[model samples]
Target: MSRQAIGKANCFHDKGHHADCTLSSYPYMAAFGIIQIILSQIPNFHKLSFLSIMAAVMSFTYATIGIGLAMATVAGGKVGKTNISGTVVEVDVTATQKIWRSFQAVGDIAFAYAYATVLIEIQDTLKSSPAENKSMKRASLLGVSTTTFFYILCGCFGYAAFGNKAPGDFLTDFGFYEPFWLIDFANACIAFHLIGAYQVFAQPIFQFVEKRCNRNWPDNKFITSEYSVNVPFLGKFNISIFRLVWRTAYVVITTVVAMIFPFFNAILGLIGAASFWPLTVYFPVEMNIAQTKVKKYSPRWIGLKVLCWVCLIVSLLAAAGSIAGLISSVKTYKPFRTIHE
Candidate 1:
């Protein structure tokens, strides 16, 4: 998405807004993947606090820029057509398509609040003085609330400005054409943020896989041994042959997969839908009920279960919708090509 943002911004800057700016996204994705491959070599999660902090700053920067740009568009009296029925069956969109898109929106929203995946990692870092869970809860609440509010502003105001024609990414996807430098900087921030964010998520998966391999092959030097390399003005760095091979292959496969799909909204929606119910709703709710020893079939327990079931149904529907979208995208998808959102 950041790659597309930068390319689109450059395209708009060079050519007029209405000019043809279509280009392949393969190189950009590959470049981003290579960066991740290097970052993936970081030896410890604890070493990533600096990256996480920088990512937070980048996120704030881009989000604020997006909101400001959206408001500016509206203020300049360039609001796109809006209707009571959001995104009506027009502009080549059908009733069925609209419904599916709406479902995709649900998943997209869920993906926006995807904090659960990183929550435990963060909690692991908290001090023991204040119970970690309590501190995590308060931190989670504040973080969620703040980010949710920003997202709402971006969604509502951006929709108000662009109506049903709004792009998936405000900074990149035809939402704003002028102020090219701001758009470029915002997109750069996105790319920077993603650099750290990808490591944050991928490190855990790497650790899991490496740990499993070490356990399975306890005496295998290829998997368990680490070689140290000294650097000028820097401390010695440790590298493992298995980690290098496994991690590189993992990144390469994922990068190729991304290029194959290249439908950001659809892919994100599908992931969000698949995980929302399981990770965000089901597990947490079940854990809370179990911890509290809530009696089965009691009013509170029943209500909670009912809500959980409702979320499950919603998640299933959202997943189906996203699948439909992916199918639709597949029909027109060209490998290594960017699918316009």
Candidate 2:
């Protein structure tokens, strides 16, 4: 393969750690965050039932996506020319890249939605006033700026405080040890936010799987005849034993490590930073500029390009700083020594 392809393959394979982290914990974070927020508002209600139901629904939804993707890959068969290791690496990288890209897309969507909603509210509040437009404009800008700062601050603070030792879900970890009221609140928030992230990442995979199953399996008749399975449960479930096993393994391993360390935030931070840069800063703008060029329209593409470059620079710096922090943390470790009589 070409050098670019090779580089991509290597990057993907090396990103196995990141893929594991994103697929397993990223969804959980948002779910837990939202669940906490809800519980905080409805403290007296039996919120655990709501939280459990939300988490179960979200987890199953994402898990179905994971299974479907695995099935599609299995059905499509391998690209024969690629090395097995390269392919494995590429898969790992793609999975993590998708997670990060989905995250940024969701962030942008959230900003737009919030801005529109807030602006509408402001317009109603200040209707017909001379300062209405100006006030709304200022508030919108302030809100966007402040929200961005808050996101970066929380991410950075979690990274800094935990270093490479950051937890898989910092907010959830807080819930575990914090006061009862706070823990309950945190769980509620996390559960809800997690469902959003899960849906964003999972829905596409579900659609892809559905498409592939229709194309390849076509009424599930082939599997029944070929595999000699007559049971309705097997067809209804629409998942293979292998896929289930693999996903279970993924969840089991990730949960075990996350529970054991619980404070390995620095590594998580570095991985997240690295993944975020390309997904958030590089890809979208590039795609936009490419599409604009294809349509023979130039709408301040240069400005967008510049913004992308700036984001790239910032992301690189953040990634470097995170790595340096991680290394420093490792260096600071000292082993206990015994005193002899």
Candidate 3:
């Protein structure tokens, strides 16, 4: 997505808005994978404070810019065609498309609000000065509320501005043009944020794999060894052969998959469907119940179980929708050749 943004901005700047600005993103994608490989050496999530802070700021900046632009478009009375519900079947949509799209929307929205996958990881870093649970509660409340508020603003305004014709990715999908520089700047911000965001998400998985390997083979020198090399200002840098190999391969594989699919929304929806319920809902809920010693089949337990069932149904529907979307995209897309050819 970040690569797409950069390519889109450059294309729009060089070619005119009306020109054929479709991008072949292989080069940019490769470039990104290489950069991620280098950034993967940043050790662990605890050391990612700078990247996390940058990602947060950039996210807010781009989101605000997108919302402002959408509102401006609506205010200027440049709104595109809109329908109260789904797009008109006779005009551009079919009944199947509508049903699938509705399902897709559910998945997309689920994915959008799914941010607690790293909740425990975050709480692990909190200071003990304040009660951890209280601080965590306050932080989660503010974070979730603010994020939802901005998300709603973005969705509502973007829809009002572009109506049924709204681009899937407003910032990079030719949705805005007149203020090309601002659009470029927003895209740049997205790239920067994603660069950091990718590491934030990937580092945990890296550590998990490395730690497991070390635990499973404590005597394997290749897997257990950590060589330190002295650096100028940063001091000694620890290099692990296993980590270097595993992380590099992981990044490469994911990069290739992204290159092959290149359908961001569908892929994201699928991932959300696969991980959201398990990582965000099931484990946490179960852990809470166990911690509080809630009796089985009691009111609280039943409520939590019902919630889990509901979320499971949602995840299943989302998975179906995402699979349908991917199939649809594959029929239209020519991997790496063009976006929608």
* Index of the highest-TM-score prediction: 1
Clashing pairs in 1: none
What's the true lDDT of residue 285 in model 3? 95
What tens-digit string does per-residue lDDT give for candidate 2 at 1-341? 01122222233355641332222333343343344332332211122345445754644443333233333333555212333232233553465443443343333333222223123323654656667868777866885675565555554444444433344444333201223333344444444545443333333333344456657765564332222334465342233433333334444554444333332444445545565546655665677677757333344766776777876665555455455544654565432211111
Over 106-194, each residue of candidate 1 has an lDDT whose tens digit, in order, gives 88887776667777777887899899999988988898998988998998899999998888887867688778988899989999998
The candidates, ranked best first by TM-score, are: 1, 3, 2
lDDT of residue 87 for candidate 1: 81
Better of 1 and 3 by TM-score: 1
Per-model CA lDDT versus the true structure: 0.86, 0.42, 0.85
Model 3 residue 233 CA deviation (Å) reads 4.4
Supply the TM-score for candidate 3.
Answer: 0.94
lDDT of 3 by residue, 1-341 (tens): 55566666677678876667666778888988999999998878888899899999999999999999999999999998988884787676788877776677778877766767566677888899797899999998998899999999998999999988888888877788758778878888888898998997788788888889888999999998889989799999999888888999999999999899988888888887888898888988999999999999999999999999999999998889889999998897777686642
Clashing pairs in 3: none
Better by TM-score, candidate 2 or 1:
1
Clashes of each: 0, 35, 0
Q: Name the runs in model 1 displaced over 4 angstroms.
A: 90-92, 337-341
